[model samples]
Target: MRTNQESKRRWRWARGVLGPFAISVLVGGSVSVSSGFRESELQCEEAYAHLEDCCGALHGAISCTYEEGCAGQTPALDVVQSKCIRKLSCSEIEALGMCDASAWRSDAGAPLCP
Candidate 1:
């Protein structure tokens, strides 16, 4: 049996991705954050970068690789939808400016943005 003093010494508070703070516990010698963490709004460039990553993971499934019979999946698509897209508002996503996108190149050697 451990005392309150002992337990207090182990667990510590961490800043959650959301505005609210959450409790983080040291498990197996590492800290594990509680669920429901939402990070702050990403800058346009940063959000674009994240979209690029998602697209990179998804592209293989969308075209060349899949057509070549090298079948692969875009795991990051869900990540982008849930983490990046959902986190940002329509205005923020619009701010990423898909049509005028110039940040990343596409699989077809064109701009990655829509």
Candidate 2:
């Protein structure tokens, strides 16, 4: 009877003490996973705006898509290129061989214009 009572006490301790901790950890991990890409998305938007300014209005508007397990990382190369294009004047796009709206569409995996 004593052993059974001790077993019951241990089980209660595990449930009462460890359960909330486990739950909290799980919840925290989930939150991180869900929110991890938020920063990248914002950066993507900023890069898109830069592309619009340089490439032309809505020109080379890339939709930033991130790889799985790549959370809070820097924007992808294409997005980075969008920002870099800001150094180029919009009027110089054709002269510089830059195609208008040639950005890749993240969802369709194809050129935005084509």
Q: Give the runs in model 2 whose Cα sits over 4 Å from its true position.
A: 39-114
Q: Indicate the worst ten consecutive residues by lDDT in candidate 1.
A: 59-68
Candidate 2 per-residue lDDT over residues 42-114, each given as its tens digit = 6667656655555566544455656656463334435445445545555654455444454344443433211
Error of 2 at 38 (Å): 2.4
Please give each candidate's TM-score: 0.25, 0.39
- What is the Cα root-mean-square deviation between model 1 and the actual structure? 14.1
* Cα lDDT of model 1 by residue, 1-114, tens digit: 999987765553322232242222234224334321222212333453544553433232221111124473322223344354536555555566532333323443322233
Leading candidate by TM-score:
2
Please give the CA lDDT of all the candidate structures: 0.37, 0.58
What's the number of clashes in each of the models? 0, 0
